[model samples]
Target: MRQTELSITVPATANLGAGLPGATLSRRLGMVTVRDSRPINPNTWTVTVTSTPFITGAGSATQTIPTSRVSYWSGPAVRHTGGGNLAPGQPTSAQAQTLTVPRIAFRKTSGNANNRVSWEPTLVIAIPSGAVTGLYRGTVTHSVS
Candidate 1:
């Protein structure tokens, strides 16, 4: 018997461009690919995503954008292969969830024998009224299990 595992592939970087205070910046974080090769009964896998606060300058309140202001929507699978039931966490912008905590970005249920799921998740950041203008950096992490 061979032991396989779940894996994920994410983009190196994503830029949401510039936004003015009290404005919203939205962009797709490129394609995220989740692969499951584990041969197990009732094979199921989930991909969870989380992000850190975007900060610049001296990291003061005005220079920070909390993770709670960052919204994520899995939208739909760009493409998939060898699947079971693959679903998006947030199917629409109306249902987009904030990144305050780790959230299920995508999942697969009841599939076996090597499956792949790919999606382009969108991120929407609501710039606070007091936000300062500068380049902000944050980390968005994706994990599969």
Candidate 2:
């Protein structure tokens, strides 16, 4: 049997949100789905995530979201029952997974459309009391192998 690589799907960009100084804010990064398309008995894979510090004002002002403040959970799952048959439902409540820079987002044990998995990651950040209120931007990159 031949093993195949894992594939991950995510939005090109997402808004973590905006808020007043000293205010805590949160935003869902939307559904991130992954699949191991390998045609072997046990195709295992892992995913990792990292991000750049949020920056604004000519890239001088900056802030970083602590990895502890980011978390993810399995979202609704779509399953392929059989020949063109599909089913969708919410799975067991998976505990929130804290994110660390270059940390593993998730792992897959096998490959199959029926075994596809997805997650919704949330970023929670607190604006410093002295934060110069303005628009800040950052990037969250995910890698799979």
Candidate 3:
């Protein structure tokens, strides 16, 4: 039997550009690919995502954008293959979820071997009026299981 496996790929970096205080910035995080190669009859997999606070200075409250201020939307899949029901966790902006906790980004159900799903997720950041001015950096993590 083939080796059962599940994996995910995410962009190394996503630059949402500059935004003024109290402004909302949104940008696409590039392509996220999930591959499932399980030979089981009823294979299933899920992709979860999370993020850290974005800090520009010493990570103080004034210089930090909490994970709760970061929102994610796993828009529709750009490409996919094999037979499976692939669904996006947040298909629209109204359904976007905060990054305060691990949220399902994508899921595949009733799929077999050699299946793949790809999508471009968007990130929206809400800059607080009291936020400091500088380049804020944060990490967004994606996992599959």
Candidate 4:
């Protein structure tokens, strides 16, 4: 009887010139109700942000919700995969840092090559007191770089 041994190896390759990081809201905040005398409970919405790097560097991300008039919807807060809950300080503005990675990567690397490159964003909406009874509307914009 004869025995043979074989060796196999895989090379690490990174495709650096394909897709850009992107994000989108799962669904609109659609038809929230606010009363005249009571402060509304914090409403949380989910945002899906893809972690594909921008071909050159780790693609960063940010989110901003403009100040709303009716119902006084304000106090926007953001929580990313990282370990901190942060406030944007004002409406209609993005945070100063790159969005945190939702999980630790396989090789201590960032971007889509690491692992599942999707992030869930938690958004909070605050409706103030004494808001006029009417249909209110606003927009939240997200970006990845």
* Residue-level lDDT tens digits of model 4 in 1-145: 5332211111122221211123222222222111111122221222212132211122112222223211111124321232222233223324212223321111111221111112223333323332332333333333211
lDDT of 2 by residue, 76-126 (tens): 443322122122221222454545546556665443443466666665566
Worst 10 residues of 2 by lDDT: 81-90
Tell me the TM-score of each prediction against the true structure. Answer: 0.95, 0.68, 0.95, 0.25
lDDT of 1 by residue, 25-126 (tens): 989999999877877766788889999999999899999999999999999898888858888999888989999999999988676778888999999999
Clash totals, every prediction: 0, 0, 0, 0
lDDT of 1 at 141: 94
Q: Looking at model 4, report the run of 10 residues with the lowest lDDT sum.
A: 105-114
Rank the models by lDDT, top first: 3, 1, 2, 4
Candidate 3 stretches with Cα past 4 Å from truth are 1-4
Angstrom error at residue 71, model 1:
0.6
RMSD of 3: 1.3
